[model samples]
Target: MNVTLPPTRSLLVAGALGLAVLAAAAGGWYWYDAQQRRVAAAYAEVMTRVYAVQSPQAPADARARAQQELEQILARHPSATPVGEAAFELGNLRYAARQWAPARAAYEIALARAHSPTVRALARTSIGYAWEAERDWGKAIEAYQAVGREVGPKDFLFDEVQFALARVQELGGQPAAAITTYQRLLKDAPNSVRVEEAKQQLMRLGARAQK
Candidate 1:
């Protein structure tokens, strides 16, 4: 015969199980919070190193050390919230070292991982800069155009990317495309700081501004 527990005893057992689950969930949350804090602290320390490496007076070994630290962070916390920023910083570091291909690779990683639109825009534009530095105008134009297609004109980076694209088009022997891009920039972002420069470019290209 099966024996049934008394009502009060059964209630106590259920309540104990419920409390255990709640305790486990709270413990898990606490651990997660602590881990996030630790990751943030680590990211901050790496940023300090990055700043030092970027300084004009930095030691020759500073960049190498910073790069190592950034790499370690990436290896340890690939899914951390700051991973994209770390990748972007790594790209900037490589760019400063004149490692154009590596810089572009890092920027592509940032583009893939960054949740913030600003960071994504920056990474995309920086990829273009890397190609531009290598005098690969076609690749530079392609990268810069990706920024426009993905981020659009309403983004704060629009005018800057437009200017870059127009400059590259001119460099690549596409004067008509350059002129049109300049005119579009003038029309779309009339109040941008780049407005004066765009106007001058239009004049140089023998194209009238959109007013």
Candidate 2:
């Protein structure tokens, strides 16, 4: 006697297969997410330890280890949330090493991709410093101005941007513009620690305040 599976049996088998597939997909996704979290946690811990090392000598090994861990995280998860932070940290390291162009590129990438306003502002400030170090006054001014506008005047980086803008103007042979920017900065940041320095700069430039 020949035996054949009933339609109900076939339907049940297909349903079970579908459920198994779904369960497998969900399990895989959960595992991948867990791995990502572990990588992120490791990166954070390393970064914290690297930052905690106060002595320059102490930071060398810590920085190297942190960088290695961050590199691994970046390799595995290029678009991860911590990737922007890692790029920013690498930019700082490059800047400290006087590798200006790489530092600037890293900072620009971090600034463009950073979701955190604070991180974006810091990346912008770092890019401006890199441009300033290269004596590219135009780029420096643009970077600082972008930071000031994007991060807003109330951001903690406001004073830094203002100072950078003023310095760029001065170095670009735009003394009058520098003076105007400095005066505005002084007015807006009357109690800023850099206010006295701004005044001295204005005096050196022979800029007379408009009464």
Candidate 3:
């Protein structure tokens, strides 16, 4: 299967003041904006490295290069608009490295920097997964619960987050809570792909879901 990678993020400041009159009046501003775009261009290199690391054709050095590039982007663009993306990428890299604690930390940074609800929720999901990987069930539950509070049922990631929340509950030694979560998904998102998954989990737990 062909895998797709995240596209490059652009500098949010409008394109260079190409007009001569505006440029002359705002020479310093234009120079700063140009520098900003130059810095933002580093995200493209990070994207390339990310794709390489995630690809089946990935080299042995791909991960090392990706980690370095992501760190560079963070260092070089501390106030860059795509700092959130860089942090999220770092979280993904740490998760892939199996450094769950650092992964959660990076995701927390991403969440703090994220302006969009979807981005924040996605960061929370990653945080939950990182906690789950560490077998820190209570923390995972808290992170996943934050997702539920952040996003609505119809949100693009709602079903996925709910399913993960239930699994965290189950693995966290709270089968009853897991069962309730599963039932809620079944009732609220009956047409969701996770519906059958929830049912299967309920059955495995030897509990009947309240349909």
Best by lDDT: 1
What's the TM-score of each model vs. the native? 0.83, 0.82, 0.81
Encode model 2's per-residue lDDT on 1-211: one tens digit a residue.
9898679989999999999999999999999999878877877876686466434676576666665665566676677777777778878767876889988887877887778878888998999899999999998888888877775445677777887888898889888888888898788878888889989988987744443
Ranking by TM-score: 1, 2, 3
* lDDT score, candidate 3: 0.81
Regions more than 4 Å wrong, model 3: 1-25, 207-211
lDDT of 3 by residue, 129-179 (tens): 998998888988998898888777788888888888888888778889988
Q: What TM-score quantifies how close candidate 2 is to the native fold?
A: 0.82
Clash totals in order? 0, 0, 0
Candidate 1 stretches with Cα past 4 Å from truth are: 1-14, 150-155, 207-211
